[model samples]
Structures are given as C-alpha cells and as structure tokens.
Target: MSDATLAIEPSGPKPKPIFSRRNIIVYGSLIVICLYYLVPLYVMVVTSLKGMPEIRLGNIFSPPLEITFQPWVKAWAEACTGLNCDGLSRGFWNSVRILIPSVIVSIIIASVNGYALANWRFKGANIFFTILIFGSFIPYQVMLYPIVIILREIGLYGSLTGLVIVHTIFGMPILTLLFRNYFTSVPEELFKAARIDGAGFWGIYFRIMLPMSLPIFVVAMILQVTGIWNDFLFGVVYTKPDTYPMTVQLNNIVNSVQGVKEYNVNMAATIITGLVPLTVYFISGKLFVRGIAAGAVKG
Candidate 1:
C-alpha cells in the first residue's frame, strides 16, 4: 500500500468507548449502593444535632430549625443511666484503657504468628493454623461461657487484665489470618535471602517482613481497634460496671425497656461511642486502601 494510504488508515477502526452501556449501568448501581449505605449516617448526624423536641417531631430527614447543641452537651455530660446522671464521657476513659493495650498486644502477637506461619515450615504449623481458622468460625457467644469459667478459675475474671486478654484472644485468629495471607503473597525468595545472610527468624520478621507489611499492618490495627472498641457483649459480661467500656455504658443509657426513650441522647451516645472507629477509619482510610492494594499486588 502507498505510504499516504497507510497513514490515512484508522488504527483497527478504534476500540469501542470504555463508557459503554454496561459500564454506565455498573457505575450507576455502585453510586446507588453508596447512597443507601450513607443514608443512615446522614440521619445520625442530623438527628444528633437536633434537640429532643425536634427528634420527637419524627421528621428524621428534616434539618433542625432550632439547631440546638444542648443534646450534644447533655449526651456528653448529663444523660442518666439508671440513677446515675453522668453522661457517656465517664466511660470514654475506660474504653481508652481497654483499647490501647488490646490493640498493641493483639497486633504484636498476630504479626509474629503470621510471620512464623508464612515463612517457617515447622512441624504442625499447618495444623495449628487450621485449628485457628476453625476457631475463628465459632461464635463468640459459644466461647463466652467457657472463657468466663476459665478466667474465673485463673482469678482473672472481672479484671481489666482479664478483659484485655479476652480481646487479644478473640483478635488473634483474624489478625493472624490477615498477616498470614499477606505474608504468603510475598515472594519466598526474600526470606531465603535473609536466611542466607544469617538472619534468624525474629530478625527476618523484624528487619524484613514486618517492614514490608505496613499496609496489612494498618488494616489489622484498624480492624482490631474497631472491634475491641465497639465490643459490648465482652465488656458487659467480662467487665465490672466500674470498668465497662463505653459501649456497655451507651447500651445501659439507651436501652431501658420501662422508660421513654431519649432518642436524641441515644443517637448522640451512639455517635460518641462510634467516634473512635470512625475517626480511625477516617484518618487511616488512605493507608487502609494503600495497604489492601499493596497486599493484593503481592498476592
């Protein structure tokens, strides 16, 4: 063919546009799903800002004309739980007390276990992991009774230490699984090279694998923090009232059967209690996304 004709020829008649009907439909559906999930959050924010009287009017979607901050103040300081009038602020420190140690201990254990399982092929490693995976499937409720008994026998029940240990135990399986999966996606050659360089197991984990697994580590931290912070059943059953996490206190405030419900306070308390997880997610959201992407790339 002539140079002019060849130059004029289209490149394979051009590919079809990416924004086809199927693509449009899929994206439209996703937008709708996102809106559906966000609606409750929108209602929560609006309702939390409203006074009790506005909430009583029952138009949850409407903006508060009065726009009072009284409910927020009351929910933080004056809401009554039984005869106690102290607000959820009282339990905030308790949640923090439980949250800090639980997250640290659980993450450390999970990272170590995951590294060992992924990099080391010890005897019964697979079996140990298999049991762990199996245990994760068991409902926490089923395990609660036995766990309480065991803690009582060990004289750890009803103590902060006991509750911290409980959170760590429940947190391990999922955390370990997360780390293991992420670690397995890493090339085995890296570990072999480290070993050849005279690095021991802990050295390889600390110096090599752990450094590379920051993304998954962030994800695990987010999961553990949210789970432990929002934990109510464990806190209520395993902890004394004095040591109750905010979720327990929030439940007590909002869940009385015989009294008229304070919907505004209830919403405020729920939001307050949820703020930690929400804040964690908000701040680390970018890190979380990056971590999942990195882990998936390695996989």
Candidate 2:
C-alpha cells in the first residue's frame, strides 16, 4: 500500500482562525458600540467628580484633576429641586414607597394571570388574552386622561397609591405575557403528575411552579422595578410635588431656572437616580438572560 493510504485524515472541518474576518467585524462593531455608550457614562462620572472651576475648563472627557465627593453629597442632601431645598432624599424614599408595592402586586397578579392562561383553559381565555395583547400596544398618551379621571373618581388621584395602581395596571400586559410564555414552556408531565397527586391550583403553583419559576420572576422584578423607578409622566401627573418620584425630582433639579446650573450635582444626581435599576440588572443579569431564552423558545 502507498504511504498516503495508511494515514488517517481528520474527521471534521478545520477550525477557523481566531482573528478571522467574521470575528473581526463582530468584535470591532461590539467594541465601537460599547465605547458609544461608555464614553458618555465616563464623562458623566468624571464631570460629577470635578469642581465647577475644573468643569469650566471644557474638558469633559478629562478625569477630574481634583476629585471631590461634595457633588454627590449636595445632590443627595442639599440641592434644591424646587421650592424645597432638600435634595433627592425625599424623592428617593417616595420612589421606594412606590417601587416596592408596585413590584410585589404587579408580579403576583401577572404571574397568576400568566399561569392560569397557560395551564387553565377557560371559556373566554382567548378573548381575554387578545384584549391584553392589544392593551400592551396601546399608547399611554391615549390612556392618560382616562386614567386621571378614573383615579380622581376613586379618590386616589395625586397619591402614591394611585401611582402604584397605574404602574401595576400598565405593567400587567407585558408581564403576564412573559410569565405565560415561560409557564407554557414547563413540562406538561410535571403539571399532570402534580394534578394526579390531587394538587389543587394553589398547591401546584406554590409547590411545583413557583420553585421552578425563579428566572422568570427575576425577569419580572427587574422589568417592573426599572419601569416604576424611571417613570416621569405618571409621577408628574398623578402625584403632587410632595409625592413626586425620583425621576420627577431629577427633572426639577436639572431644569431649575433659579440659579447657575451645577453640572457636577446634576451628573451626580443622575447617576444616583440610575443606581437601583443598574444594580438589579447587574446582580440578576444571568437569570434575566436565562429567563428570556427559556420563555422565548416555546412562545
């Protein structure tokens, strides 16, 4: 036999180079996009650290020559948002009050709705789900006045409770959709076994579904928290100044026409306002990705 006939060839295709054209294009685009977002954030951080004199030097990209945390302190405690000399502290607490109840109530209700829709067949389930799908796409502008009147009639207008209700309602369509899709992806055998064990609705949910639904729940929590925390139009229209949310207060602080604009304080307050959602995303980022992938696969 010839020498070539005795040798074995590799079974699979050869590996591509690490720096292939496709890799270069994808990675280069990603790097550029990262810089696009990260540069502004870098400027905001550096500007927040520098004093007014250094800021006026017109070098926004430059790191602070003399770093000071006074801007953060002022933004937290002393910056005048309006008639009130107090800074973001009031708005921060108000946002928390608004955030917690909104997240809890919305998640609970939406998860239940999703589970029922996915697992429990009913006469009008299709119709109800269709309505919810439409509701998700309805422009908030169209519903604004109607919601205001509804809140006013219920004596919840201009209150945190009213705002909470608004958040919960608006959050419903999307969250319910997310949970429903995720629950639908769950193994039918497990659900059937739970039923065979004489498990009721609540029993199955609490014992079987809830234990496996952590990723979706985290996804829901992060979405609700971000939406409720960053809401401005609702916060402005539904509540008075005393109960204004952090976003509203941030707007007031940034737009105040009363004095020289403190760029440092504005930047500091902006970062502080964004911290919660950013923190939540970073902490549960993996879960969020997993939940999205799981929920999207089946639905």
Candidate 3:
C-alpha cells in the first residue's frame, strides 16, 4: 500500500557536455579571432620594448630579453615626421583639438536632431531623415573634393578648425541616426507625461532623455572618437603638414624614407596612436554593448 502511494519523479533534460561539437566550434572560432588580433598586439608590445639590436635578431613573437622603453620614448618625443623632427606630440595635440570639438558639436547637434525627429513630429521630418540616412551611405571619398572647396571658400582649409568642422559634418548623419533610433525606443508615455508637466524640448531632453541615455551617448562617443582619431584621409587631405593629426604624423613616421627603418619605433608609435580609442572602448565597453542591444531591439 505504501509503495503504491509513492509519486513518480520527473526527469529533467540531460546536461550538455562542456566540449560539445557546437561549443567547440563556437569557442574555437572565437579563440582564432582573438588570437588573430591579440597576436599582432603582442608582437607590437614586445617589439616596442626591445632595443634595435634585439629586435633585429629576435623573432617578433619572442618576449624582450632586455626590456627597454627607448622605442616608445623615441616614438613619442623624437621621431621625424616629414620636415618636423618633433615626434607625435604636436600631432597628438592637434588630434585632441580636433577630437573634442568634433565629438561635442556633432553629438549635441545629432542628439537634438534625433530628439526632434523622434518626439517633436515636425512636418518634413521623414524627408529630412531620409536625406540624412542617405548621406551616411555616401562615400567620404566622393565628397572629399566638395568639402575641400567648401572649406576653402570659407577660408578654413588646412586649419584644425576646418578639420573639426569636417568631422562634425561627417559624423552627424550616422550619429543622428543612432540617437534617433535610441530615442524612438523610449516609451511614448514618458515623453507625453513630460510634455503635460510643462517640459519643453530642451527640458525633456535635459531632464528625461539624457539621464536615461548614458549607454547610447557612450556608444556615440566611442564611435566618434575611434573614427576621428584613426582617420588618415581627412587629416591628410584637409590639413597641412604643420596641422597634421596623429594618424597623419604616424603615417609620416612609419613611411619616412630618410633613415633606416626603425621597426620598434614604428610599432611603438602605432600602439601609442591606438591607445586613446582602445582605452575609451575598454572603459565604456559595457555601456556600448547595452546601447547596441537597446538600439537593435526596435530600430
């Protein structure tokens, strides 16, 4: 009688193996991709630490037996870029000057455009957005000459101010699209409530949209910083030798034909040039992911 009263247990799904075929394939691909990128980075770091003799004799993959920061110091302070013997210091400052205003002005204008398009519902909004989206797809190479002329007409050519304006304009379309998509994801109720509570455009933007928009802003910042910082085309074309940005200076340093190739110095300079964007991404990586996911959901 007691045995007959016993309940039957339910069998749950079997645990998947850690080394299952799917897991192995996915993890293997990831490992390969990571190594593909990390190996070069490893080589760069190691080579940057090695002296010229060690770098010449040793395999690039090998660790530095005698670590020295001479290459890094040279790359940062003493490397020649065309007629200028001053390393990347001037270019670095130029880049900073270009980056700050470009990022700020672009983000502010784009965010406002996005907010208006998403919530304000003005006439011709769709047409305006379509044109902007269209602009994003237009190759920068195609517009380079046009921009040069425009800058020249306004007398901004070869100036850091001109570069800043170029970056701001180029960045606007994509950044506006990102911000618009993100703002569109915000609940209509919140926007309406803010409006009823006497919040105007700027008020809602400052009080409501912005606080909840840290992720997207981080995403925008990362995108703009990376693009502007690494841009060689614009930096080279729009500015003269003296106003060259870090990327342009880096190109000159790496490609200079006047002396023996300083491989260690070149590698160090490359890494140094890349560090700003890398640091920015690493710090705000989580927010970037969150923003991307949020944007993906609805737009």
TM-score of each: 0.88, 0.93, 0.93
Clashes per candidate, residues 3 or more apart or on different chains: 0, 0, 0
- What does candidate 3's lDDT look like per residue over 253-274, in tens digits? 9998887999999999999999
CA lDDT of each candidate?
0.88, 0.94, 0.93
For model 2, residues 106-151, the per-residue Cα lDDT tens digits are: 9999999999999987889999999999999999999999999999
**Candidates in descending TM-score order:** 2, 3, 1
Best by lDDT: 2
- Give the TM-score comparing model 3 with the true structure, all chains together: 0.93
Which residue segments of model 2 deviate by more than 4 Å? 1-19, 295-299
Cα error, candidate 1, residue 117 (Å): 1.1
When summed lDDT is taken over every stretch of 10 residues in candidate 1, the lowest stretch is: 290-299
